[model samples]
Target: MHLVIGGAYQGKLEYAKEKFNIKDEDVFTCTESGDLPQGSKCLYRLELFTLSCVRRGIDPCGAFSDIGAWSGCVIICEDIFCGVVPLDPLAREWREATGRLLNKLSPEACSVTRIFCGIPQKLK
Candidate 1:
């Protein structure tokens, strides 16, 4: 599996598409409907997915575990734990859970990259 992480608008999705040769149609963005695309090689905005899971009262870790089972999948999410901590409980929980999920998923990933200023730096 591959993990691409960065702050919002840092071009993580563009990096994944260029590097993986993934077409726009193949990329799946998490939504309130919770309709994840099965068999997709790339999944983006996992931070939003974490928030969606929290809003639905679902365990984000478990959700990530289930998604991570798809080997060779490219996961894109923002590093949400940085900057000012949210005053709202739900927002805080989402940030913390996203960090935890990334921690759990990164070790299992064959490659991990962090993007900044549209440049990707490999971490694993």
Candidate 2:
């Protein structure tokens, strides 16, 4: 699995598409709803997945226990924990959840990249 992270509007998805050769059909946009699609090759907006998990009282890390199920997958997550801590309790929990999730994924990922101003910086 590969991990890509950056702030909003950082072009992480475009870079992932070029680097991973991911097609539109293979991409899944995560929102504050439903379960993660195990079949998708590229998972976009993974921060939202954490939010969904927090909202539904689910464990994001547990959902990804089977690393083998995500082999060759390209995962994109927004860097929302960089700024001031959110005042809202749920948002703060979401940020912490996403941070933990990324911490787990980064070391396991075959590659980790951070996009800034449309430029890709390899982090792993």
**Could you say which candidate leads in lDDT?**
2
For model 1, the stretches where C-alpha displacement exceeds 4 angstroms are 33-35, 66-68
| Residue-by-residue lDDT tens digits, candidate 1, 1-124 | 8999998899999999999999998888887548456567888988888888888888777755565466768989898877898999989888887888899888888999999999999999
Q: How much is the lDDT of residue 58 in candidate 1?
A: 81
For residues 1-124, could you state the per-residue lDDT of candidate 2 as single tens digits? 9999999999999999998899898999998887888867999999988999999999899878998898779999999977998999999999999999999899899999999999999999
- Report how far residue 14 has shifted in candidate 2, in Å: 0.6
TM-score of each: 0.92, 0.97
> lDDT of candidate 2?
0.92
Give residue 32's error in model 2 in angstroms.
Answer: 0.7
Task: Compute the lDDT of residue 29 as modeled in candidate 1.
Answer: 89
lDDT of 2 at 58: 92
